[model samples]
Target: MELGRLLLLQVFCAALDAGTTWLMWSRIDISVVLARIAGAFLAAILIVLFCRRAPEFRGIGRFLATSISLTCLLVSYGIFALLMLRNPVLQWPLAFAAASGASLLLSWIGYWRARQGRVSG
Candidate 1:
């Protein structure tokens, strides 16, 4: 995708994360908030910009990938960040890895489907 769109998406996701954090947590911490926001921003970029045939963003696979990636990031980092900053949690890394893996797999699905002439946004 274009740099402007990408940046706007990131900012939008960050704002969402921040707003969620504020709504959920009575006492907000810095590291945890940053981590969640960063994870969301990263997820959006990975699923959208880096998806198969990308910049073009077509296909059900792309849509699924975006949802899967965003969900993984929000659930994993958003929850784990609350505890990980105070004490290390192995699940945090594992969850982030899972987010990455899911995005990659979904992107591959999109790629294969597009190759099969099945790219319809």
Candidate 2:
């Protein structure tokens, strides 16, 4: 259940990121593709760092979490690239992908830390 929730959260975050990116691109006339890619990459790095620092998820789920984080970043960027256009509704998939990816990464890190503590103890 927690994992499911985390997945959902990741998807949500990704969506938000995509939306924000689109908004920025539309309003600022900036390079939407570059901005969106950069945002996802930055988010992924942050997720990994945060998970690593988290006391709970130190070692147990590190790999899984990192995978999720990486996936979400990739999905977010991919989806944005594929769906971001004049049409607003077509972008949901990318957003969801990004969010799910982030959640998984975070969860993995937390689990990893907890396992390490247990093993040491």
For all candidates, what are the clash counts? 0, 18
Quantify all predictions' global Cα lDDT against the true fold: 0.48, 0.57
* lDDT (C-alpha) at residue 96 in model 2: 45
Model 2 agreement with the true structure over 1-121: per-residue lDDT tens digits: 4344445546555655667666767787786666676557656766677557644433345555556556656754655565555445655445445545544565556545555666897
lDDT of 1 by residue, 1-121 (tens): 3333433443455445545544434355544445456546654565565545455443345565455445544554544554555556555445444544453444355445544565343
Candidate 2 lDDT? 0.57
Task: Tell how far residue 89 is off in model 2, in angstroms.
Answer: 11
C-alpha lDDT (0 to 100) for residue 100 of candidate 2: 50
TM-score of predicted structure 2:
0.52
How many clashing residue pairs are found in candidate 1?
Answer: 0
TM-score of each: 0.36, 0.52
